[model samples]
Target: MNDLRSWRVPLPQTAVKCAATVVLAALAVLSTGDPQLVFLAGIAALGAGALALRDLLAPVRLTADAEGLTVVSGYAGKRRVPWPDVTAVRVDERQRLLMRTRLLEIETRDDLHLLSTFDLGEDVRDVEAELLRLSARD
Candidate 1:
């Protein structure tokens, strides 16, 4: 088996955003005595804190080797698909709002796995090429 190669979702930016949200929520609660504003701030803080903790605890990771592919998604935990189980690997593009995003779709005999570009940390095409190369060796 070859060495396992791993890719992780980029979270520094998200960490910063979460921190900013918490700070802003704190400031809002401190600056105003209004109960309504304070309640809203508290809710914001809770949501932001939850997101931060989730990102810290369960980061998305993708690992591949001679054997197969492993995906560790936040909240979803981990899933492993062996090479023989993978029926196809392709790049999928979707438009959300005004932005277009690319993702890697791995189709197994009984299931499908979608990996975001953020999680793959590389061009979907490159990941697809690697998948093809690894699958060919089987």
Candidate 2:
């Protein structure tokens, strides 16, 4: 295998959001003093903490080698697709009113894998170009 290239999903902002959620939940429990409110806040704090821990522990990683690509998604586990199995690589764009987003889709013989811009940490066009170059070598 050629030198393995890896990209880490950006999560500093997400970590901040998670921490804020937990803090707010704690404050709600302390100020409200309502059993129901406390319970709800506890649940929210747990959920947010779990998400934060998941991101910290099993952070999303995208790796490419001479053979193919590997995606390690937190909680969702990992997936590996060889270049021979990849039939097409394209960018899928979605627009919702004024908001627009792009995703990289890798079409294999039997499945389609979607990669978010956040996970790629680079432009989809550049990733596509690299994938094409690596695939062409084989």
Candidate 3:
């Protein structure tokens, strides 16, 4: 449990998907001369390109260290949480449609942050264990 100290998690899959969306939309815009279709495709391409840039750029989705954690706020900015402010970090497991899903839950006084494997790029149990170890030292 004490082998780790910090972590930076990024959503690579999402970035790849966004990049693909941008490419496909750009192609659609180029292929169609219809004003309405071109306009829609151009908008879609721009939005996906923005999202792709965000995902590919340096500010990763989640970062953790001995002092605290920081998460990118969808496109707004980064949100930092000190260790003292963290109330709990656990795996929230649920069953739906005959499938089991697990998410990492980080709770604070005012907010509950839930992260999936797609978000963390790591198993929730592993993340929970590392987080517990970090918090235990504090």
Candidate 4:
């Protein structure tokens, strides 16, 4: 039997990018004189920035089951890998989870998401341990 566990990745880059976009947009608004153009740009930039932030702040969920592992990155996309196909699991120097499989490379970059800005951290070890346990079962 394979036990299951879940993990989320830390996000810092996302937040920083979102903040920079917002700040730049604000600056643009201040520098522009046309009310119509300024309003339109401001709305567009702010809206896009907010959406980007939402994506960054969203969770990157990792769920492991008997057959394989499923990684759902908010609305970005999802990755499912069978245990038997996984070739290696390692933590990179950047602290990202590097998962290599027969067909894919799953790089979980903790700093690329925005959750870390809020001091949120994920337990990659738990996910790695579950993957190990499942791989052994097979």
Query: Largest lDDT belongs to which candidate?
Result: 1
Clashing pairs in 4: 11-113, 11-116
- lDDT per residue for candidate 1 within 1-138, as digits (tens), equals 585777665778467758867796886769677888778777778777776665566565678888998876446478888988888899998899999988889888888778777666678889888888877753
Backbone clashes in model 1, listed as residue pairs? none
- Tens-digit lDDT track of model 2 for 23-138: 96876669675877777777778777776665666565567788888866436577898888878888898899999888888888887777776766788778877777777754
For model 2 the TM-score comes to 0.74
Per-model TM-score, in order, reads 0.74, 0.74, 0.71, 0.48
Each model's lDDT: 0.76, 0.74, 0.72, 0.55
Model 2 misses residue 124 by how many Å? 2.5
lDDT of 4 by residue, 1-138 (tens): 657665553456456657777876886668687777777767777776866665565555556677877765456566677765555654322433684322122433331222221222444444444566766743
* Alpha-carbon runs more than 4 Å astray in model 1: 73-76
Model 3 TM-score on a 0 to 1 scale: 0.71
Better of 2 and 3 by TM-score: 2
TM-score of 1: 0.74
76-105: candidate 3 lDDT, tens digit per residue: 377889889988887999999999999888
The residue ranges of model 4 lying beyond 4 angstroms of the native Cα positions read 9-21, 33-58, 72-75, 94-120
